[model samples]
Each structure stands twice: as C-alpha cells, then as structure tokens.
Target: MSQPKDVEADLVFWRRLESQRMEVDFTKMAPEKCMAAMIEPDDVRTVHIQDIRGKETQYNLKLNGFQYVWHDMPELDGVAEQSHVENVVVPKTEALRELSLIIWSRTGATRTVTFAHRVRCLSEDEAMLANNRAPAHSVHSDFTPAGALKNLESVVPDVAEREELLKRRILAINVWRPLKTVQRDPLAVCDWATLNWQEDRVTNRMVLPHGWHELGKYAFRESQGWYYLSEQQPQEALIFTQFDSESEQADEGGMTLPHTAFVVPGTETLPARESIEIKMFAFL
Candidate 1:
C-alpha cells in the first residue's frame, strides 16, 4: 500500500529576513532598496527533492498550480534535436503562438480569453539579457497582484476590453519547456495550495525597463510541496501559474507556483540546460 518515491535533491529558497527588507533586481537596473543583495549559495538549504515523473498528468493546474505534459513541437523538433553550427533556425513568434494555443486545449483551460501573443525563441549562445542568463536558482513567481494588474493594462489595448476582462477572472501563466533534451538544471515547482501565503509569501519590488512592479518571492515552509520532471525533452512542458485575479478566493483556480531551476546531482558533466518560457494571460 506504499507509493514509489521519485528524484530527490537539494533545492534553494529565499531566507526569511524579517529584521530588514531584502530586495534584488537580477538585471541590477532597478533603483536599490535597502539590503539590495542577490541570492547566493550560502542563502540556501539542501532540501532533498524527490522526482515526480509519475505525477505528470495527475497534477492539476486548478489544484496543484502546475501540470506537466508532452507538448511536442514536431515542426521544430528536428531543429532542436540536432547540433547546428552554421545556421540555427529558431522557431518563429507565430510558431510559438500556435504552440501555446495547442497547449491551452491540452491543459484544459476553461478560461474564455482569446490569447493574443508574440513569442520569441532565445538562447544564451546568442542574445543574453537579464531574462536570458544562466538558469536562476532562487524560488520565485514572476509577478505580484499589482504587477499582474499592470500587465493587464499594458497587454489589453482597448480600455473597454480591459475593463470587461477585469470583471472576469484573469491569470498570467508561464509555459516552460526545454528546446532540447535537458541535461541538467531541471526546474522544481511548488504546489500553490500548500504554501503559507499569509505568513511566508515574500514580496519584492522588481524593476524593469517598462517600470517597477511587485514580484512574489517566498520564505521556506515545510508544508510547501515541490515537484519536477526529470531529463525533460523537447516534447514536454511545465505549465504553471504566475498570477491570479482571485488570488484570495478559494476553489476558484490555482494561484501561484514558486519555481526554481535546481541542479541535478551527478549531472555537471553533461550539457547545460537550454529552455524557453512563454508568458500568456487568460480571461474567464
């Protein structure tokens, strides 16, 4: 009557520093807040993680805050599977958009919002920015409540449409995948329901070129449940929630997923992880 345990490894989380406000901008482009320090190796704990390969489809986006599936892109699979030196054909924006739409149906998103997006295929070997750096190790969610609202303002061009969409449920979710087979640095995501939102959620001011907005960081809690897929390939994806309109409501939908790229033990000799995540919104 016992279940099988999966991959377990040490992953890092933000330390709780109530004495002083801790803030950071990975790009270092934002104005400094007191204790504007970055997450270092010393600021982490080795909470051994067990792999969750069996929970691929079992994890529900409405309940667990994350779901894993084989979202294969056959159109671009050959481009990723092989090694190219002379010319690398990146998936076009339209392709990524079409991919997201396909994934939406697979994920069982009941939201009625019509997705309008411009996706990009970026690699560290080419353009490097705050977003395109080494896989970030800190556990965090991309946006705060206010930030999601700001994002709605920016994305929805028409005022009437924005207001109409605001009346319904809104969500900002990230669809992440490895362009190629991941050798190391697989991502670990926390179940949103298990988080102690009131007591442990750490809010940070993230400055960006557009403007500064609140970002959700976390202080560790044993009750928080984390899971990840092993050796993720080009055919799979890790879809999770970033922001929710009814964040304070219950039984509405998944809220936030605290995710980080954790190093897989004994995989350092393998190739570095190369991945892409596209952010999209939903209106219900």
Candidate 2:
C-alpha cells in the first residue's frame, strides 16, 4: 500500500506572518519581480514520501480522501505538442468532458460536472525559462472560498443562474495526468484528513498571467500529511478537490486538497516532468 520512505522531497512551506506579493507583465509574458525570495530556505522542508500505485491499491475521493484514477485517453497522447493541442481544442474539450463524467460516476455522487475553460499544461524545461506558466511548487489548494465564488461568477455570467447554482453543493475538481512517464519532480498531495485548514492555510495573493485581477492563494502547513504515486505513467490520472461548497465536510477530511510538484531525491538524470491539468466544476 506504501513505498519506501528513504527518498526525501523538497516542498515549499510558508513562513509565519510572511507577506509575499507578485506582479506579472502579461505583455512581456513574464513576471515583473523575482518571486524566489518569497520562498526561503527556512520555508523549504524535506519530507520522505513514496508513490502509491492506484492500480494496485484503492483510494477514494470521499473515503480515502483522494483519488488516483486510471484514466486512459488515447486522444491525449500527443498533448505535449503545443501545435497538436492548439489544433484540436474541440476534441480536447470533449475528452475532458468525458473524463469529468467518469470522475462523477466513480464518486457515486448524483451530480452534474461542468468543465471549466481554464486548462493548463506544464513542463519543467519551460518553467525554468521563467515563463510564469509553471508547475506550482508551493503547497496549496487552487482556490479559497472567496476565490471559488469569484470563479463561479465568471463562468456563469448570468446573475440569477449563478445564484441558483450556488445553492447546490459545488466542487472544483482537477484532473491531472503526466504527458510522459514521470521519472522525477512528481506531484505530492496532502491528505485532506490531516489538514487543519484554519491554522494551516494562509491567504496569499496570486496575480495570474494575462489581464486578470489578483486571486487568493493558500500557503503551506507543516502538520499536513503528504503522499505521491511513484512512476506515474501517462495513462493514469489524479483527481482531487480544489474547493467544496459544504463547510461541514472539512471536519470529515473531504474538502479541499493541497498539492505541489516536488523534486524526488536522486532522480536528477531522469527526464523532466510534463503534465496537463484540467479543472471542472461538479454540482451535486
């Protein structure tokens, strides 16, 4: 059920009372300031983790608190190629929609899943170029309560429809898969059951690329329990919640999941990591 813990991974943690800010010049497609010092050596910690293979072990989104799914889509095999993605937006969207449906069925929730327009693909080589669109290395969830509300508004547009949608149980789920075989720099996620959201998560500002207002970001907590799946292949997908509308669910550890890309010690010679992540909204 677990792998060896001899290997350590470096993750970005938040310092107490540390104020961090970032500004991006979309015109230049770059960050206006060096966002490095926002993370300090003191803020970085090494934790031992082993990858859990979903095929061999069982993980439930509501029960085990996370889901490592075997989602194989041949249409997405060439997703790493920018040209291929750009040319096949329609097929990509359809494929993602099907993926969301599969997640909903597996969760056993009587809900409708709406695919979000925001989909991202990242590569370690491109991230080293400081292009702003990089695999997030910090330990945090994708959205806070306020951020999730704002996102819903943006997607719905109509006031009455948005309000109606808000009355139901809403969840933001991310479907993630590696573009190639992941040899190093794999993603690590914190078990929701172990997270103390109130004391562990701090609100930070995130200035996204393009002309968008600053959004809320969460900082890391040391008490969190982190896990990863070793040698995650292209055929598998990891699905987790970014936001859950139900407040009481937090007590049961089925709310938001915090995750980040971490360097797996001693795999430096392996190929750099490339992955695609798509966000979907599920209403129950």
Candidate 3:
C-alpha cells in the first residue's frame, strides 16, 4: 500500500532559552504561566500498510516507534453513557488491565503489567469534563524519569519489592485509541529515532488539583520527524512508550516517545475528537 501523503498541520513546540512557567490547574481552570506555542503548517507524515496480516507491522513495536493494533472491546461502548466515577470510570479501568496484558505479550517483555486506574479523554470543548479526563494539546511526554520512579513507588506500595523491581527494567507505555472514527484533532507522534534528548527535550512543571509534578516536553527542531495514522477507527489502538529504565537504550532509540494533538488544516465542520488513553508500566 502507498503511504499516506504528508500534510501540513499546526504543532505546539516549546521555545528554548525562554524562561516560562508551565503550570496548569484543572480544578480552578486557571493556567498561571504556560509556555506552549503553536508552529503552524508543519508536515506530518504517515506509513500505510495495505494489510496487517502476518507482517512485521503486526508485532514490531520498537522499530515503528508506535504500533497500531486491532483491539475491540464492547465494554468500552459504555464509556459515554454516564459521567459518574463509579458508573463509567471504574469499568474502563478493568478494560485497561486486559489491554495492558496484551501489550505485554506483544513486546515479548517477561514482566507483570500494572495499569494506572485513571484514564484520559480529549475533546474539542474545553468546558466538557467527564471523569477527570481532558485533552492535552501540547507536545509532551506524560512523565519524567524522576516522576516515573515516584509513580512506580506509589503504585507498587511495598518498599522492598519496589526496590527490587527498580533494579530490573521498567517501561511506561500509553495505550490510546479513539472512541469513534477519528477525523479531527488526531494525535501525532515524533519518531523515536529522530529525538535528541539533550537538544530537543525540556522539563515542564504541571500543577494539578491534587499536587504539582514535573514532566518532559519537546522543543521544535528542523530534524524532528512526525507521523500519524489517518482516520483511525475505534477498534485499533496506538501503543507507544513514554519511559524505559534501560539507560543504554537512550543512545540506541529509547522507547519514550513525544507526541501531541494538532488541527488538520482545511477540514471543515469536523466532529469533536473523543479518545481514551490509559497508562501502564511493565516490570522486566
């Protein structure tokens, strides 16, 4: 199959040497100081596969930077039925665990998968809040190395066991898919091979309702390469890594990928983007 033609889209990239505060408060709806700015009309490329049957595309995760797999769950249909924490949110968490295990098998990683209970959904209407999920428009990774370790401790709970697990490798991955066929504000991820950790990454401090934390964001660079799957359906999922414990892998294309949402220019009257992202860690 021919690859999807590259199209121009607006991507938010951080400015270097600019002293800016990136603080977002979801509860108060007031962002004190945010540094994210848009760089419009940038090209986003795509790789098209005629058929996913018995090909390297079906199993390879590290080479592609991200893998698109077919995963259909009828339980996810109830996601928009109610906004309550117990009614709609809890069931989705159960689904995430099942999804995480499938990813664990695909990666050939012999480790247990621990999924975070929280799930994130992004939409066009900023005012629309459902179960503490919101759309993140900036180009960023969800966790920093320090932040990932902290999160690991919280989830594992046992100090001794957590310490033992830390000695081994750990991978932080996000499983993302659209609630419906995605036509607007789809996600675009930078290829891992194109990233230069020292030159292209920046740390951002996030202020949430519960507490403040730090994460990494990407600054625009001419050499950076971006890709997105066109018109993704609900049954397909995009799995990409945000953090990996192997230090040597950093030089050889680390799994932590940078990504963001963008407006596909020239599209008129598109449906609002609705999607779910679940985070999980694989202990190896």
Q: Which stretches of candidate 2 lie over 4 Å from their true place?
A: 1-6, 18-31, 34-42, 54-57, 81-133, 207-222, 251-254
Whole-structure CA lDDT of model 1: 0.62
Q: What lDDT score goes with residue 39 in model 1?
A: 44
Give me the runs in candidate 3 sitting further than 4 Å from their true place: 1-5, 18-60, 81-122, 125-134, 207-211, 251-255
Candidate-wise lDDT, in order: 0.62, 0.61, 0.62
Least lDDT summed over 10 consecutive residues: which range in candidate 2? 123-132
Candidate 2 per-residue lDDT over residues 1-284, each given as its tens digit: 34544357777777655444433334444443434433442367777655566432455566445677665667666665666655663345445545644654544335444544223344442443224355677776776666667677777789998888888777777777777777767888777776666666655444455334333334555566678887777676777777777745563222667788887767776766777776767776
Cα lDDT tens digits, model 3, 172-272, are 87778887887777777777677777766765655567665667777777777677777778777777777777735473223467888777776535767
Give TM per candidate.
0.74, 0.75, 0.73
Residues 1-284, candidate 1, lDDT per residue (tens digit)? 12534556666666776632344564555433322354441256666565676657677666777777665565544543333211232334224434444544543334433222212332123323243446766787777676667766767879998887877777777777776777678788888888777666666765555676666677778777777777777677776778777755433233567898886778766777777665777655
Report the error of model 1 at residue 86, Å.
21
User: Residue 148 of model 3: what lDDT?
Assistant: 76
TM-score of structure candidate 3: 0.73
Error of 1 at 166 (Å): 0.4
